[model samples]
Target: MGSQSEVMHCYEQIAPLTERMLVLARAKQWGELPRLEGQCSSMVERLKDIEPLSTLDEAQSARKYVLLGRISANSSEIVGMIMPQLSKLVGVMKSLDRQRSLHKAYGQPDDAYLP
Candidate 1:
């Protein structure tokens, strides 16, 4: 937003991080996601703070459009990959809750339910 180049540079920096996130997601390296996601979020917050002083020229606009499209696509795919795992986790949590409730109803000791 400071200049056409500065805005474009920010976009340029974000594009690779999104690509890396998509690669990690595809590889099912779930543990690395939060760290990469934090980095991407920080970049996006920086973009939001930028005040547009000038408009992008045709080529820069095109590149920005492409980078945005890639970022969106990669994010969508990552969500798709994560949803099923999240669902399974929710199921496990619900099951644990149910077991806890049943044990309480029966007046069982705290350690009665051993996994």
Candidate 2:
């Protein structure tokens, strides 16, 4: 594990990214979500690497608890916002796949079969 400071710093970094992700999700800015999520994931990976050996002071533990709660809340809200959009996208992809399969089976170009 890293020192208390290192662990705390990772949490601090993750907090704001999660907040931004929530904001982006709320605004329906889907394109930016993955970029911010990737950044947050990297910070979490760093924490995982350094967390095993570190011990937090009382104050640091309290702050860590707060930050984690905030992160969780933000993540939950983001997921709530994204799930509907993801479902719609999955449906569209499945529709496209079915169309492609039908086209292949009948040897028809997609445009020829369009209504």
Backbone N/Cα/C clashes per model: 0, 1
Taking the tens digit of each residue's C-alpha lDDT, what string does model 2 give over 55-113? 89899999999999999999999889899999999999999889989998989887876
Off by over 4 Å in 2: 110-115
How far out, in Å, is residue 65 in model 2?
0.3
Q: What TM value does model 2 have?
A: 0.91
The global C-alpha lDDT for each of the candidates, from Candidate 1 onward, is: 0.85, 0.90
Estimate candidate 1's alpha-carbon lDDT, on a 0 to 1 scale.
Answer: 0.85
How much is 61 displaced in model 1, in angstroms? Answer: 0.9
- How large an RMSD does model 1 have? 2.2
